[model samples]
Target: MELAKMTPLAGLVALLALAGPGAAETFTLRIGSGHAVGPVTYVNTSRDFLVPEIEKRVAERTEHKVRLIEAYGGSLAKLDETLEAVEKGILDMGHVCFCFEPSKAMVQNLNYFIPFSPPSAVQQLAITRKVYDQNPALSEHFSTNYNQTLLALSGYDNYNVGTKFEWEKFADLSGHKLGGAGPNLVWLEGSGTTVVQTGIPDYYTNIQTGVIEGNMLFPSSYFGLKLYEVAPNYKIIDMGAMMVNGLLINNDTLAKLPPEVTDIIREVAREYEQVTAEALDRDQAAGIEKLKAAGAVITVLSPEERQAWAERLAGLPGAKAKEFTEAGFDGPAIFRSYLDAAKEAGYSFPVAYAIE
Candidate 1:
């Protein structure tokens, strides 16, 4: 006989087996991130700000039934391996650097690396969110290739030079050993300087040992990593914002979560998304103050010089965008939309560099 036509006992046993795990146990999800337990750092912001916020939101929405175990400061896994770790279930949730996984999400990081584009953190984050929300293929690609889901993005500031020497313009930067990460290399290309590529965590030592004359970084990173003591010239270039980082979760873990819990997590991400932008502004101001107190030279690039530098780097972005588009994502269009959004947001690009 068919199972439906069999016994009542068989039906009850089947139902019990199907519902057993969900009804019998409480789930403790382990959320992992690379930053330390407290404030934001070069490693990540979501670990410091977004994780707690998400936990609070989830608890409030789900009646405190769900528990999340936070693994911070690479206690669970290395910073560069976050995406892979999440995919392998070594981490249930993580703050992944899309730059580190460029093969998986080059379009997103290309916005950061493309020179002379994305003028502000708010605009950058806005466009990134819009693009991800609109592109099903991109989202599916992340899910299928990495087994992870992008929960939120942490925007970056316009990188500037913090150096031992005064640099009033890009021309003044010639022949300096500027330590920086990926995109800054492109920015410094024609400046006649040697670009020393080093991790943010290693910047302090690199400077202290005279391995680099200066480094390009956002103010928060300069302050967070104590770069002020070594190279104290803070010069704002306003070239563009870096993509900085992203928060992601294991696709399987996210899929298995109660829908309400997942919704709460995303809700908190939407709220914390602005934290990086606002914090960047504040940190930039604070970094200027700290540099002044430390007797460092601060030079704001003049309007004419900033204009020249902008024009010089402008072509690089389009070229890089083509490279990304060829790899299959519409990088040029994404970059254009980002710039257009920045214009719509009332940012007068080439704001005359002046001391406030």
Candidate 2:
């Protein structure tokens, strides 16, 4: 009988026959993400690279052959529900964005609290990983509170400035209108720019129809949205290349795996972080070129001016550190530590914010 046409009982019997007496067990897993496959790098890389790479490594390195049942675009779980969904066993594993779980994973999102990071995804992820290694509670919370293991970390592309008009310095944005969803709003605080509460979907029409003149968003998103047609100027803010997305697996599912398989999965997951970062770096670079080709003017904010903008937001990071410190995590040290790590790695911030 064809494998696809076989009944459940027959398939089990056939599998046993093939294993013949000393075969290891294979596991089937359901993995999904709320965001669709294309727009979100985490979803795209998870679907194309992480899943298949795990299968290949498991097959090559272990006795078990694992299969992942894929679902993207919220087919299995919505955005904010992914972490909880995996916890409840509704999904064996899934990709999660901490932005959706503000209360649940607040400290995990320190990357956002302290902005003006380099646009390089590689550096963003490395700094976050170092912080995680220093602060065990950050990763521990996943298993301690959510009943899941964080297998890998993922980051978005560079968050640059896209505007309908050209501007040279931070002061140039004064009296202009811009749009952002949340958290990122503070980055524009000191500048007298009016911020419209809008999302990526509305950025195009909002700019075209005069609702807002610019948006603080990722380059790939800006290009993908065709905002260059309207917001034809790009500012290299390199605001926050955050490693805010993670791949998670339920502890129960992980506990069922043989040690060998578990090791392979974890190793592959770490590698997934690096490969996805490389992909984001490429997308960000390529997207800029595409934007220029499509008639967008690009400008790099001078380090001096960038530092001035960072100074405006210097007081904020400490406030966020307290929130985490009060939650019993080492927020202060980590915040300062991240800045130090960034500096040691030779990526200068516009301004070095202190964690009081």
lDDT value, candidate 2, whole model: 0.84
**Highest lDDT scorer:** 2
Per-prediction tally of clashes: 0, 1
Give the clashing residue pairs of candidate 2, or none.
Answer: 307-350
For model 2, the stretches where C-alpha displacement exceeds 4 angstroms are 1-23, 169-177, 193-213, 302-304
lDDT of 1 at 275: 78
Tally clashes: model 1. 0
Q: What is the TM-score of each candidate against the true structure?
A: 0.83, 0.85
Candidate 1 differs from the real structure by a C-alpha RMSD in angstroms, to one decimal, of: 5.7
Q: Give Cα distance to truth, residue 110, candidate 2, Å.
A: 1.0
Give the range where candidate 1 is weakest over 10 consecutive residues by summed lDDT.
347-356
Model 1 stretches with alpha carbons more than 4 Å out: 1-25, 37-49, 114-120, 348-356
- Superposed by TM-score, candidate 1 places the C-alpha of residue 5 at a distance from the truth, in angstroms, of 25
lDDT tens digits, residue span 111-177, model 2:
8888788788988998888888877778889999989999888968888889988898898899999
In angstroms, how far off is 40's CA in candidate 1?
A: 3.3
Q: What is the lDDT of residue 142 in candidate 2?
A: 92
